[model samples]
Target: MKAFDIAIVGAGIFGLSVAKAAHDRGMRVALIEKDTVANGASKGLLGALMPHIPSQWNDKKQFQFDALRTLSEEIAALEEATGVSTGYRRVGRLMPLYTQDKLDHALHRQDESQTRWRTAETGFSFNVVKETPFKDWPAANTAPLGYIWDTLAARANPRLVSAALKAYLEPRITLLEHTKFDRFDEDAGLVHLGDGSTLMAENLVLSAGYEGFDLIKDLTNQSIGSGVKGQSLALKLELPVELPVIYDEGIYVIAHENGTVAVGSTSERDWSHKETEEPTLQAMLDKAIQFCPVLEGAPIIDRWAGIRPKCRKRDPLVGLIPGHKRLWVATGGFKISYGIAHRIAQALMNQIDATSGTQIHLPETFTCAYHFA
Candidate 1:
């Protein structure tokens, strides 16, 4: 039995983020995963790190903005430390402004975004541009209107980020693959594994994506979160300029640094969305073609699908699971998981460190206490 200070189940971005945060703080951690790393929503090809509209300022939006602002530097530092590229960049985003009413609303947000988003460290700006921001950018000839260009928006290679975390913490943490965390004997401070192996840990953290809901249901008999199916596609197309992510309707046209344009994502709440091609996906692709005419003849290299977790409140669910002392959960980021997973991990660790604990100032809406209440 390995004695660890913190034992985290699930190696999604959330779990990996916790492991990195804990390991960096000199805590002995056990990273447990049922499958290989980054197999969940964390590894999705479309890494749209775009910020909120910056209007109607709320704690959750502020938290996400701060995370998005600092993420580039944070990932850069990690890349320098481990020599792994997260493919992160603050390239900004462009959204088609169709009607004048929509343009007026976005312009209003532009002012609001500037007031809050602008700071010393990060100079994120919003503007309504007439001409295309970049050559070969998706002007979407169909909609002969202007675009909203937001400088705060960024993108990251989710797969690379996961790999970087694994590499950075490889030497410091105990990573268990094909290992299942079956049950938690909270009072005994023991974790029962599937292979009949038990681990003694001072505290436990659950950062499992959608599966975390099931784990919590089994342990507490409560359905705290559910999974939302998201489907995306990767296209093999070389672009001349590095364009910002083009978002229109539900389609996201992302031109990655690797010269492959990633387009996609249909949100399906009811039925299962599989990797197999279907009409819904085709409709999205058709809409995408209308949005980005250049991608009309692009090759569809891969289709990726995953279920992002959604808590009751629809924000991130973090903090102690109800009625449990040694157990804690950090999940349900849904679409914004990648944007705020690092901060969620940090906040969870701060919460777990009750005795001589470090101060973690998180939004009230993101805490589990509020969610369960």
Candidate 2:
């Protein structure tokens, strides 16, 4: 059995980020994934790094806001170190206001949360626009709706970002792909692989997304996560679009590199993790064309679906398991995984270090017992 100081299950962005953080701390780390790297939601994401500013006014939304605020610089550093363009673009976000009442509501929310929750240093900007600027877009539909431009939000190619993180951590960490974790022996501090091999580790971290819940169900005696399926599509547009990421009426259209525009996504909680449906594809296309008419003639290049891990309280479960000292969890990041994974991983590393008396003081929400109870 190969022993390590830390073993992380799942090679998604969350797991990879954790591995990198642990490795940075001079801990021997092993990252295990059931499939190829980034094959899960980390690969299928639209890579919108939009912070939930409206939700940040309340105490409940503090964790996500803080995580995203911290991840801004962390992601840039990671990209710089890896020399791999994560396709990170701080192109801002345009959220169209359909009605005056909606605009008023958004303004009120922004005003309420601006002081404490807004990330000004990271270029979080917002303003209402009255006109439809795009020549190919429908004037009748978009002209009436005022839009809010959020400068802090950004987008990246999720696949490339995950791949870059993996490559960056390759020399420092052990990556095991296509290897399933059967379970773990808490007392022995051992992780059992599907090949009937056991790997020893003093500490275990489960960043396995929705699958992590099942692996620990027998020992934990509770459901910690569930899958929330999302459907997305990519269209190769005829003309290049320099439009900021547009969010209107729950649908979003983001400009991608190489003259391609990515439009998504449908939040369907009842759907399974099966192949994409024609109706879903057409529905997304209809909305994309409605938002940006330049996509009318664009060819459909790729369409896919991914399952986001939704927790019971719709927040992530970080920190160590309540009763288990060596076992930890860092999953259940519903839709904000790509945006906040790096920061969450950093916080988890701090928590582990704190347990070992190497550091102290993490936010109360990040502690595992907060959700475990």
Candidate 3:
């Protein structure tokens, strides 16, 4: 049996982030994946890193805010190390206010953003403007009142980010693609693989998207999470690479650097299989075109659908599992995984590395014990 300091199940953004953080700490790590890397929801096209409403803030929101605030530097370092661009940019986000009530609500947040989004050096704006910076990026009629230009939001190419991390960690860690984690024997401190191989690890992390929920249930006899199906598509359209992400009524239109704009996604909880419905996908495309007329006749380049894990309490479930030694979890970021996975991974590492003398306090709600409770 191979020996490792830690074994991580899942190669999605969450698992990959943890593997990188652990490897950086000079720990021997093993990343096991049932499918190929980023084969889950992390493979989707829309990568909107928007923040929650600035009002009624809480620890969860603050944690996400700090994560987003530092992600640019993190991506820059990853790119420098691997020479692979994650296509990251702080291009901001746009939300058209269609009603007087909506516009008033947005106006109220401007002051809140000025206060909450401020750091010692800079602050992001939640300004409501009369028109978009570009013509018909969002049709003028879409916002009868005004639009929200929030500077706190940013974006990255999810696939590229996954690639960069893989490139940086491939030589530093053991990556077992096409291998499933059958179970673990805590008594023996070994992880059993589907191929009947066993590996010894001091610690184990289950970050296998929704499938992870099943593993947790088998171990704990409780339902801690569920899977939500999301569908998104890519359009072959040329737009300014710096164009702000357009978000309206649950539809997102993101312009990527490769001249292919992304439009997505539908969150469906009641689904049986992982398949895309043409109507659902077309409806999103039609609405996207309504917001960005330039995509009126754009050709569909690719379509993607996958299940994303949603924890019981709705926040990301991280940290050590209560009542269990050497068992941990770092999954269930759901829709916001791309924006905060790196920080979530780091916080879990801080908890795992007791000798480091530094701890990152996570929101009480984000703990695995909270979900189990």
- Give a tens-digit lDDT track for model 1, residues 285-321: 8888886778888888888888888986788888888
Model 2 quality (TM-score): 0.91
Task: Report the C-alpha displacement of residue 84, candidate 3, in angstroms.
Answer: 0.7
lDDT, residue 282, model 3: 96
* Candidate 1 lDDT for residue 17: 91
- Clashing residue pairs in all predictions, respectively, total 0, 0, 0
Question: How does residue 126 of candidate 1 score in lDDT?
Answer: 82
lDDT of 3 by residue, 1-373 (tens): 7899999999999999999989988899999999999988889898899898888988998899989998998999999999999989999999999888988889898878887888335667788899998778788988888799888899888999999999998999999999989998877899999999999999999999999999998888999999999999999888888789999999999999988899999999899999888999999998888878889888998999999999978989997777789999999999999999989988989988966634667999998768989
Which scores better on TM-score, 2 or 3? 3
Overall local distance difference test of candidate 1:
0.83
Q: Order the candidate numbers by lDDT, best to worst.
A: 3, 1, 2
Question: In model 1, which runs have C-alpha deviations exceeding 4 angstroms?
Answer: 119-121, 140-143, 354-358
Query: Once all C-alphas are superposed, what RMSD does model 2 give against the true structure?
Result: 2.6
lDDT of 2 by residue, 188-210 (tens): 98889999988999899998877
Q: How far is 191's C-alpha from truth in model 1 (Å)? A: 0.8
